[model samples]
Target: MLHIWGRISSINVKKVVWTAQELGLNFQRTDAGGLFGIVKTPEYVRLNPNSTVPVIEDDDFVLWESNVIVRYLCAKHSAGQMYPTDLRARFDAERWMDWQQTTLNPASRPGFWQLIRTPAEQRNAAVIAESNAAVESLMATLDRHLAQRTYMAGEHFSMADIPLACEVHRWFGLPQPRQSRPNLERWYAGIRARQASKGVLDLALS
Candidate 1:
C-alpha cells in the first residue's frame, strides 16, 4: 500500500490522490498540513525538507513534490499508456505538467488564496483582481492550446492532465468573473467527468 501524508484540501495533495485513484492504486492518506499540524515533526521533516503537503511513501521509498510524485506513479505503474511512452509525447506531457506548476498555479493562487482561504475583511482586493486577470489570460492560453487537441498532452489522457486539471479546478471554483473560454471549458468538462475526478474535482476549494 502507498502511504500519503497530506490534507485533501491542499491542491497538491488532490493531485496525488486523484492520480492514485486514476491508476487504481490502493492508498491511505494521512492529514498532515495546515490545520492538521503534523508536518513540522521530525518524522515528516525527514520525508520532505520543504515541509509541504503531499509526500508519498511507497514501501521504503519516499518521494515529495506533487508533480514529481504524479510522474513517478504514472511511469512506475502505467508506462506505455498514462505515462506516455513516445519520446515526443512524453516530453510534451512533461511540458504541460511544468506549465501547470510554474506558470498557471502561480498566476491563479493569489486569487484562490484571497477569496477561498482568507477572511473577507482581511482580503486584499487588489491582489485578487491582479490574480484573476492573470489567470483569465492563462485560461485563454489553455483555450487556444486545446482548440486543436483534446487533452493537454495529446489525444489520450496522460500524466499531464492531472496537475493541470487540479489547477483548473482551483481557478474555476474561485468566485469571480471570467471570460467565456469554450475550448478550455470543453477540455475541463471532460476532466471533471472522469470517474477518478469524483472526490478531488467535486470538493469545494479550501
Candidate 2:
C-alpha cells in the first residue's frame, strides 16, 4: 500500500488523495503537518526535507511534491485516461500541473496564510488585500484557458485537471469579488461530481 504523510486540510495533500482515489490505488494517510506537528520529526524530515505535508512512500520509492505524486500515480496506474499516452497530450496535461505550482499557488498561498493560518487580530490588512488581488489576477489567467477547453490540457479529462481543481475549491469557497467565468464554473462542476472528489476535495477548509 502507498503511505501518505500529510494533513487532509492541505490543498496539495487533498490533490494527491483525490488522485489516488480516482486511480483506485489503496493508500494509507497519516497526519503530519500543521496541528499534527509530525512533519518536523527526524523520521518525517528524512523523507521530505522541506517539512511539508504530502510526502509519500510507495514501497521503496519515496516521493514528495504533490503534483509529481499525482503524475506518478496516474502514469503508473491509469495511463491513457488520467495521465495520457501521446507525448503532446501528456505534455499538455503536465503543463497545467506545472502552471498551478508556478502561478496559481503562489498568488493564493499568501491569501491562505493570511486568512486561515494567521489570526484575524494578527493579520496584515494591506497584505491580505494585495494577496486577494493577486489571486484574482491569477484566476483570470485560468478563466481565459478554461474558456476554450473543458479541461486544462484539451478535450479529455487528465492529470492536468487535478492541481487546479484543488485550487478552484479554494477560489470558490473563499469570500471576495470574483468574476463569473461560466466555462471555468462548468469545468469545476464536472470534476466536483466525481465520487473521489466528493469524498476528498469537497471537505470544508480547515
Candidate 3:
C-alpha cells in the first residue's frame, strides 16, 4: 500500500491525491502540515526537509515534491496515458508542469494570500492589484495556448493539467475582477467534469 502524508486542504497535496485517483491507486493519506503541525516533528523532517504537506512512502521509497510524486505515479502506473510515451509529448507535459511552479504559481500567490488567506483588515490592496494583474497576464498566456488544444499538453488530459488546474481553482475561487478568457474557461470546465477530479479539483478553495 502507498502511504501519503499531507493535509487535504493543501493545493500540492490535492495534486497528488488527484493523480492517485486518476490512476486508481489505493493510497492511505495521513493529515499533516498547517494546523496538524506534524510536519515540524523529527520524523516528518526526515521525510521532507522542506517541512511540506506532501510526503509519500511507497514501500521503502520515500518521495516528496508534489509534482514529482504525480509524475512518478503516472510513470509507474499510467505510462503512455497520463505520463505520455512520446518524447515530444512527454516534454510538453513536463513543460506545463514546470510553468505552473515557476511562473503561474508565483504570479498568483500574492493575490491568493491577500484575498483568501488574509483578514480584510490586513489585506494589502496594492499587492492584490499587482498580483492580480500578473496572474491575469499569465492566465492570458494559457488562454491563448488552450485555444487550440483540449488539455495543456495536447489533445488528451495528462499530468500537465493537474498542478495548473489546482492553481486555477485557487485563482478562480477568489473574489476578483476576471477578464473573459473563453478557452481557459472551457478547459477548466472540462477538467471539472472529470470523475477523477471530484474530491480534488471540485472542492471549495481553502
What's each prediction's TM-score?
Answer: 0.98, 0.94, 0.98
Give per-candidate clash totals: 0, 0, 0
Task: Report the Cα lDDT for residue 45, model 2.
Answer: 86
Question: How much is 138 displaced in model 1, in angstroms?
Answer: 0.8
Question: Deviation in angstroms for 70 in model 3?
Answer: 0.7
The models' CA-based lDDT, in order, is 0.93, 0.87, 0.93
lDDT digits (tens) for residues 23-78 of candidate 1: 99999999999999999999899999998899999999999999999999999999
Per-residue error (Å), model 2, residue 109: 1.2
Model 2 lDDT tens row, 22-53? 88889999988888999888988899999998
What TM-score would candidate 1 get against the native? 0.98
Worst-scoring 10-residue span by lDDT in model 3: 197-206
Q: What is the C-alpha RMSD of each candidate to the true structure, in Å?
A: 0.8, 1.4, 0.8
Put down candidate 3 lDDT per residue, 1-206, tens digits, no spaces: 99999998899999999999988989999999999999999999999999997999999999999999999999999899999999999999999999999999988988888888999999999999999999889999999999999999999999999999999988888887799899999999999999989988777766
